[model samples]
Target: MKKHIFLFAIVCITQFIYSQNDNIPEKKTQKGFGKIDFLSIKMPETTIPNESNMGFTGIHYNLMMNDWSYAGLGIYGAVTGERGGFFTLGINAGIKKYFTNNFYLDTGFHFGGGGGKSAPDGGGAFILPHFNLGYNFKDLSINSGWSYVNFFDGGEIKGHQLNVGLEIPLDFSYADYDVAENDYSFDGLQKSNWNVNSKKSSLMLHLNNLEIKGDDTNKNVQNFGRATIRLAGFEIASYLSKNWFTFVKFDGAYDGIKAGYMDVFLGGGYHLPFNKNRTNILAKFGVGAGGGGGVDSQGGFLIYPDISIEQKIFDAFFISVNKGYVMSPNSHFYTSSYGLGLKYYVERNGIISDENSFSEGIFKGIEVITKQDLYFNAKRDGEPTEDMHQISVQINFDLNKNLYIAGQTSFANFGNAGAYAEGIVGLGMQTNPFINDKTSFFAQVLGGAAGGGDISTGEGFIVKPSAGFNYQLNNTLSLRTAAGYVKAKGGDLSSPFINLGIKYNLSFLKMN
Candidate 1:
């Protein structure tokens, strides 16, 4: 396994170096310009004994001048051991070039590999033949290709391999032969422009089949043979300038059980274009339906409506709010939920398209408090009481122009007076997942801490890692709900908590 991983790394680095050649347009060529590239490779799926998986890491450097390509020695290695004590080593060399803007070919021979003998015997040699197809617009480039590996004396390990990968150049530089003044700039402007033009579409098709078996009294059920089908979906949109443009999208899901259900959404919105680029507000509305029990059955219609607001603060974070309503009767048996959510985006995109923005700095306001309490008290030899209240607050930070981090803190004050504050804090990485719009998703993790009080004499911390899917509804209001496990430390009793809540976002206050 180690040997195989090492060889794979060498191939990856070689490819990266070849791809980074200076493919710039120029006028004169008294002295041809060259380019240097570095590549990294990752193994697909391979498991070793007592080890999670066997993989290799490689770094290759290549230089390209005119049509002649030269690559030096590459180094790679793999780690394989039982829990601990693992080692690896590898080496390789190769030469490659592009025949066209989209097609390239290469041939490489790799040797020298090693792995842990006690861990697992994973070693092999190979002669690799590679072919690649690539498309470049501005700064964005997409490449996919396959390679054939001929193993030298390895058991059942020589065959053609097919894999796909993507490359996102964090910084790009090009040489200009037309002018003798300076090389190209790495300001990321060209790369950003390329990203705007080379946008691809996403196609999504979902089919669900469900089975239920239980009595109406308990409502307890089991699921079986729930077939899920996902088809390709596509969309294409680009930025006009900074944060303003028009976009159209088509997304829907279908299920083939219990009268089935289907939903389709198609709508678009643009940035306000006035409050610098740090603040973006958008609205989307679409129509969808669900039905199954044959055509005679009454098919229900649904309205997909949402609004989103994003604001940046300081220079290292941001905050956003979303609210929306979904009216559907097929699934969840004629149920409707209105939701509001708040989030923070951190480590921004390093661009400040706007400076004098009103939504700058951190938006810190008096925390909003909402509570629901349940009490049970007894008067006798002993007194017992229990109550719970939910409290929530929204926080926003200005990470940069294109990035920000948002979060929500919610706690359940058990009202035991002595019971420690028990609640959950949700932290999410926010990004605009739509084209020319501010629609985004929050990848979050929830956790909390508890202290021993009069009610329960114990102390400990609680951590729950959870993931939630959120859609921005509109400005001022947002909807959010999440499910996560609850663990108690210092004590023995623990239970998971399912949380749901709505928030109202208020911003741009005058400071006294």
Candidate 2:
């Protein structure tokens, strides 16, 4: 059995590689550019216009790992309005080679298949290769490509695509290129890409209304009159160029008739200047993920594309009006935000480089966290379950500054009509429980397997969601309190839980 398994694993890996670049040449060429991150959008069926119903959209993060090689991670999807579901997303790994200046060849593969309607053979056995040829000029690129998805039952999806992409410059050095001959101005950058000589950081406070909308044609799923608030948000960002900037934002909003909610998002955009920098028109595009509006604590994937106009009235103060949509994938709807706000800028010769800010982040905000807790089950089979001590640990990953993704597992008393153990994954949102920056709050929505206990019904599934608060008393310790609900298969909603435990804020040692 071991021999058979090992052989099978080898075969699968071989197949995965072959599907990626079997026909591409292995020739070497001039190393062109350094590492960078880029986002690309593909127009499917570009070659054969008749197949336009299925389109492609994607965002990719890539880096130059070596002199001759490039590595990338891509999150993309396939769909068309009134047709295929947009949720058929794909995560891809790819490699590229820059044979010469601004020209490249690439190939990528996605093992997670199933793009559209069901077929006799599950797309699980499908692996695809998307190949492309592209040319780069400054921070932008255009490409032509083709992708082939092959399923085991002889079913396939093939498409030719045209794409436009933008690269986030990672290096600021002006001496890397032959500017005199290439006309690169500085390090292959166009004149517009140069950073402003008088550098400054700004804060934008915005309040907007969130109007939600979506429809499910398959089952007639409809939602309406659901409104959320942008209440207010602060964007802490810096200018990359006179025309471009990136922002990290924190916000507080009302979740459609609820108390309040929070979110964090990272975005970038351009400023169309007017009147010699006194007034500017702006546009921003980016993606975010957040949660924590209701009892479920479920997180939502967000796409924020907005436009605004800013007018400088005082030496350091400004005003603006913004409008945009907070597109959510899981919710299948968008929250439209439009309102007015104020902005203030502080000029500094250089960016902040103090260790104090980093320290404050540890005390006030953490990018990733691990939590452990002990709790009791409220009831089981319509009866209050007894001292049901449970141990659960969860890893929470921040999607944006305000939202996160959580994966967790719990061990419980399985013999008493409650499950023994379960593993779950969900979306969530959190706040800095700011009792002098010593506390925090969070919520999540999780669903996964719930079974294996002696008294559990064969093997059942469960949706376990929660909301919690944490207070820190020391560097290594904190106190936790949480309330959660577990709705098992067969309408079992009797297992609500409350827990208290000591939390350990894990940290790593960094070298100076």
Give all candidate RMSDs, comma-separated. 23.5, 20.0
State TM-scores per candidate.
Answer: 0.26, 0.38
> What tens-digit string does per-residue lDDT give for candidate 2 at 294-350?
312222346678898889998657898888876655545456677787787644322
Steric clash pairs (candidate 2):
264-402, 297-444, 299-427, 433-440
In model 2, which runs have C-alpha deviations exceeding 4 angstroms?
Answer: 1-52, 78-81, 88-91, 113-126, 151-239, 246-335, 338-512
Q: State the lDDT of candidate 1 residue by residue for 288-317, as single tens digits.
A: 332121111122334555565666664423
Error of 1 at 389 (Å): 35
Error of 1 at 270 (Å): 2.3
Clashes of each: 42, 4
